[model samples]
Structure formats: structure tokens, C-alpha cells
Target: TVIRNAWAGDPYPIDTLMMYMSNMAWNSSMNTVETIAMLTDKDEAGAYKIPFIIYSDAYYSETVPFADLVLPDTTYLERHDCISLLDRPISHADGAADAIRHPVVQPDRDVRPFQSVLIELGARLGLPCFVNEDGSATYRDYADYIVNHQRTPGIGPLAGWRGKDGGSIGKGDVNPDQLQRYIDNGGFWHHDFSDDQRYYKMGNRAYLDFAVEMGFIPCAEPIVFQLYSEPIQRFRLAARGHGKVQPPDAERGRIEAYMD
Candidate 1:
């Protein structure tokens, strides 16, 4: 959910907020918000539905007129759990689930436990109709499910589990005891496997995750790629035949040398 932080006064127009959202890399998937509105059309009718943005501080300033029942959740202190799915391998953390996220310190507003609110919401929504039995969505140990599904070779469970004794990592690795080996070798894995079908590289594909990461495509045109390489502007970094510069200017064997 992208909640844009409103200023004290001189409130900005909705168009401004919309433009701000369109320009930023964070909310590039503008359609996700629309999709949410579309998906819960059955449930919400004309009311706003749940937003699914990675960042929560983006939707604001008269844009979401359909918003109803706003729930103000706390920062790190109020959360009883956490998640650990790093899109890039470089950002790994241990015990990503457990972070001492208890309410021992207390809050300025109504002081209530996090678990209670979740249980209440579940009862109201009537989700997971079978297992919950009461035709409600129970708090199904989301933290546990997160730890189990999002394991990425190093991070382990929150409680009742010990990390590698020899400083190795394993939870997400394909090899057995690889996690342990990583620990023994000071957090490093020596994978000996050669290139297989999994390493498939195609010149061009219908779609790619990188297109999103690079911000070359937006949610409005999720299936389309923006013209990053204008033929009018030549580039030396591009490969021989792939250079965007049109013929006679920077095409193969035409110019004395393709300048950077």
C-alpha cells in the first residue's frame, strides 16, 4: 500500500500526486493499484481495496477517493513478525523473522497486541473458509510460512531452530550441508555445477523481470518496453548489430569508429 505523506498545509492537487507517482521508479506498476480496485470489485463494490506495493508511502493526496476503512499500522515496533525475500542475493540477513518486534516499550495511541487485531480482521473477512471452519481467515502463522517459503540459502527460522554449527548456510541451497560449508568457509559457496537448461539465455524473450527492475516498462504498459535506445542517439556500449544508431551513422562498418 503506497501512502503518500501529506504535508501540513498548502495541500497539493491530485494531478500532482499522480504525476509524482508516474515519474518514480517505486510506483512504476500503476496498474497494480487499478488491478486491486478491479479484483475486489465484487467485495468492495465502489470502495477502495488492498494495495500491493513494495513501499507503503506513495498513495495519497485525493487520488484514492474510494478509500474506506483506513487502518493505521505502526512501524517496526508494532510488527510481531518480519519477511526476508531479497530480490538480489547481495542483501541477506540472518533470523530475518525474529527481530525483537514486541510491544514492550508501548505506544502513544491505544495500546493493544498485534495478534488480537489480526484475529479480529480474519473473523470479519471470512477468509480461508475451510480450515478456519468459522468461515474466517485465521492468523495462519504467516511468519512461519514466510520462513519456509522464502528461504534463500542462508537465513533460517525464527525460533526453535539453530543455524549452522560450522558457520555454513543451507536453508535455500540445492546442495546438502551447503549452508554448513558456507559457514566453515566464512560465508562462501563453491558451486561446481556446469551450465544446464536452467541457465538458458535467449537474445529476446516475451517478457523479463529485468524490464521491471530497470524501469523500462510501466504498469500502464506492463507488456511493452520503452524505447531506451533512440536510433538518433548512438551508443558505443551496444553490441555490433544491436546498436540503435541508424545506418550510415553508427551501423556496422559504416563509421570510422563508433564513438562512445
Candidate 2:
């Protein structure tokens, strides 16, 4: 959808396309030839159809050539990373868990961590969340943000060893030494579900309650499975010209064909 949006200029034309670690020109693309064509294709004015592109990658992959700016990134062994609970968590059917990656060795080159670069970029752009009330940068780096930035009052990227003294789990106050706590615990944290919360998760009362406590769900209501999705139907209806926002003529056919 991102490629399609940039290629067609649907809704509106974009000024810049920023990508991180995505190899759309080759490995990640379903049709590499078509993807490359779309990436390099120019408009009538000789401007690229997708306009400017900024890409960050640890290695010089095939997609780097298409980018207008290439921000070199640090390798995994030289950067801090989190397999966060708020993002793609490492969870199983019986329990939920999260992990982190701490740099074992410092980089010998001049490359910086992509996450830290992005954080600096966010601050430079004066994003509301990245700036303080006095208009100063709120976080010094990615590690600073990880420890103090709360998505909600008590919830953050990690789900374990929370609170001021690092005794709480699931939800609590921000812990300044969260990264150290993760490091001390073998770079990971796991929460085991009780017997009642182990199976039939969607409709299980105990599981639902636990999910709410962990800020995974809004409430403790059983999640009802839907065979038919209304959002998908809405898009299909829009393809038939039944909405305030409709797809372009070139895209209507594709939407109708695949929306089902």
C-alpha cells in the first residue's frame, strides 16, 4: 500500500518517502522488476513518481541506490533494540514475554544506531511528544526515551520490572534503570498465565482480565470473532462510488478485485 500510494500519488503527492531496513527493490518485493520500475519511474516533468526517498540501512543493499539520502545504520551487535510488548511481542499461547538487545561491542566505524538517529530527527522536527514544554528536546537518546517515555501513565514499551524501584510488572511508574533491569535478567522477561487464563483466550474471562491489566485490551470483555468485517465492506462500497472519499479510476478495478 505504501508503494502503491507513492507511485500513484493517491489522496495527495508526498514530499518525501522515509524507509528503514526495508529491501523493497529486491528481497522484500513480490515482483522485484515491477517494484524497481515504480521506484525509478519519472513523471512528465522528469521528476520521480515517488519523489524524494530517504533510507536507513545497516548494509548497502540493492534498494540503497534508489534513495536520495542514505543514512548508514549500526549493526545489531552495536545497537540497543527491544522486542517490545507494545509492538511485536514474543508471546506464546500460555504466556506473554518481551526481550531486548544490548550492544556487546562498540562500533569501530562512524555509523550510529538508526533508532537514536530517528529520535534526534523527531526532536529536530519539534514533534510535540519529542519536545519539552519549554521547547527543548525531551529525550537525550533512544535509551532515555525507553526508560522515561510512557505511552500511558504506567505502560511503556516493556511490560516487566516497572515502577520507581523496579518491582512492579504489567503496569506501574517509569523505572529509570529499566534497561539495566533487562540486562540483569538475561535480556528478557516472561509472564506466565495461570491455569484458568491459559486456553480459550478470546472468550476466557480470566485471560481477558489479565489482558486488561497488561494494557493489551481496553476492557475485560470477551472478544467476539467476526466472520464478516464491516471495514472491508466499506472499502468495497467505496470502490462502487458510494463514499465521500473514493479511489482513483485506475485503482477502483484493483480494489474491487482484491477487496473481498
Candidate 3:
């Protein structure tokens, strides 16, 4: 293994100019190759070894003597394309996104995107910067590529919290044929409660009777006004000092105190 990969463990991040990803882990590592090139372009010991050491910044920190350029990455509002996610066996809102992330405007940054960064570096080195048909370059264009190659099986969502256009995702008939029918109807339907799994709650007389008949368990009267000691709801009042104790509200509500 290379020195950087040896230390960085599995799936080591190698970068442009054959540097490790960790080499660019910090600001000081930015423009590392450029600094080395400037120094070693003529100097004796600085020759070859300088760029090599600069490249090694992924594994070793002191190797980078200086940096030359740095580009600010864009915000969520300034980017597009793809993202990676793990398998989701369980999701809230009946398999809907738990939160939303919508951008009001298109990408406004003068920045090459994550994939474009790699492609840009490769182009400078005269290496195959993601080849396209008719000898065109593919790496430089992500927005177009996403539309062309299309999204992968589970990735490539620009936003996280968009509600289903009509209903929901992954809820409906369990049978394969029925599930396909639901997908045909725009990927939505009511949940299949075929199993009839029920959580215990008061006023469920039928469930209580069934439980007793099975000699399983007896239901007890639920307590009224249960002492609900919870985390003190905390928010700052403009007039209150930092970390100061303040009443929750003036609506004659319960005063919950919890100190731990």
C-alpha cells in the first residue's frame, strides 16, 4: 500500500497528482502541488522530492511547506447533481423523507462540483478526464450527465424533504402483482394492515376481552394527570440572560422540572 493508504486505513482517498484525500484534509494542504512545483522547478533538493512530499500531505502533515490557491465550496443553495445514501429499511411518514431540503434558485456559484473537481484535475494532467462519445469530455459536466446516464437505483436526489406528489412511498398491497399496480397508480396507497398489529391503549374493550379470554393479561385503569417530568423546554427570551431559568408560558400550564 502507498504510505498514505497504509495510515488512512481502508478506501484511502487518493487525489489529483496522485495525492491522498487526507492530503487535502486541511487548508494548509490546498495548492500543495503548485507550491512544490514553484519551489522545485529549479531548486536542488526541492526538485521532485518537494512535490512528492506535498503529495504525501494526505498521510503526513509537516510535508506541506506552503499552499497557493483555495476555492470556497458552495452552499446547499449553490449546487446540484448527486448524493449517496445507505439502505433504508425503516422510514417515517410511511417511507417519506423526514425533512425537506429545497433550493429556491439554481446553482449560482463559480465552482466546479464535487465530481467536476476530479475531472478538472485530470484534464490539467492530460489524463482521461472521464471520456465521452465522439472524443468529448464527460467529467466536466455533472448536471448534464445526471440527466443523461440518469440516477442510480437509490441515489441522486437534490432535495430531501419533498412530499410525495400525491400520496406516499412503499405502502400498499404486499403481493408483488398488487404492489406493481400501486406503482402504476403513481407509487402510493394506504398502508396494508393485514397483520392487524395493535398497540395497547385504554378503551380498547374488544382487545381487553380477547386478552382475558386467552388468559394472557388483564388491563388496569390508566392513571389520570400522570406526573410528566421531562426535559425543561429551553428557549431564550430576549430579556433573559444567557442560560437563565425562565417560565415556559403564562397559560397556567404544568411546570415541568428535570435536572440531570
Sort the predicted structures by TM-score, highest score first: 2, 3, 1
Give candidate 2 regions above 4 Å deviation: 243-250
Each model's total of backbone clashes: 11, 0, 3
Model 1, span 1-260: residue lDDT tens: 23332111123312111122232332343555653344234323642223322212223423233333323344445444332223322222211122223333455664333344454545676645213575644334443233343233334332212243433222321333432333354433222212231232121232223323222233223343436635423443343455454343324453325442
What is each predicted model's overall lDDT from 0 to 1? 0.33, 0.88, 0.35
Off by over 4 Å in 1: 1-66, 86-104, 111-126, 129-260
lDDT of 2: 0.88
Task: List per-candidate RMSD values in Å.
Answer: 15.6, 1.8, 18.5
Name the weakest run of 10 consecutive residues (lDDT summed) in model 1: 7-16
Error of 1 at 123 (Å): 5.3
Clashing pairs in 2: none
Q: Cα deviation in Å at residue 49, candidate 3?
A: 5.7
TM-score of each: 0.29, 0.92, 0.32
